[model samples]
Target: MQRFQGSPRSVLSTLLLVLVMGLLLYPGLKNIAVYLFSAITGNYISGTHSVVFLSCPNEQVGKVIARTIVEKKLAACVSILPKVFSIYNWDSEITETTEVLMVLKTRTSKIHRLTEFISGSRVE
Candidate 1:
């Protein structure tokens, strides 16, 4: 009891610790507004949004494209999942390669804007 600061069976102890921690950590959690909002409202978000997926040959290119979209606000967030195996036909050869997959989340209203941005940029 004296050494176990993280005892799983102490429900009251956990609650009290969590309450104190919340109060102490409130100011540091400003960036968590979206999560808190979703929890309180039981809604994903205010806007209608969708995710668009794109794959790049490597992590570096994937990161660059993802970063560019996010920086331009074309997407709310871009997740780069690496080491994905892809098989496809390019030119006259069948090719298999390891790639990075980017899942971009953005508002539905911004789809056209996002598309335009992607077209204007060299990523498409």
Candidate 2:
């Protein structure tokens, strides 16, 4: 009975420690995740009223993604820049490529949902 009581107290202490660690890490982890997502996708959503910059492989994908976003009411407006040069590192290689730029205008609150929609759109 004494050994079992000690085990329960130790288990409770471990659980409390885990809880505290989780609470401490959660906000920072969230920020890091947002930063990484923005860095990787280039959807650099900033400010209260936000603009997200996304690059599509071509005019067609750009149009499709832009139009679909607007139609779904995720963005008030989306403008497609016909041709843009993008230079970035991928797969440990620096590559320069031509792509269409899609400018998305929406409130900051909509950014997460908009990102989710784009993620499922399969345009990449």
Span of ten consecutive residues with least summed lDDT in model 1? 30-39
Show pairs that collide, candidate 2. Answer: none
Per TM-score, the best of the predicted structures is 2
| Residues 1-124 of candidate 1: C-alpha lDDT, one tens digit per residue | 4775655769677888999999998865853775577668877775456889888888888887888889999998999998999889999899999988899998776899888887776753
Please report, as a residue range, the 10-residue window in candidate 2 with the lowest summed lDDT: 41-50
Residue 21 miss distance in model 2 (angstroms)? 27
| Residue range 1-124, candidate 2, lDDT tens digits | 3555568789999999999999999988987788778769877556436889988899998888888899899999998997798899999999999988888988687999999988877865
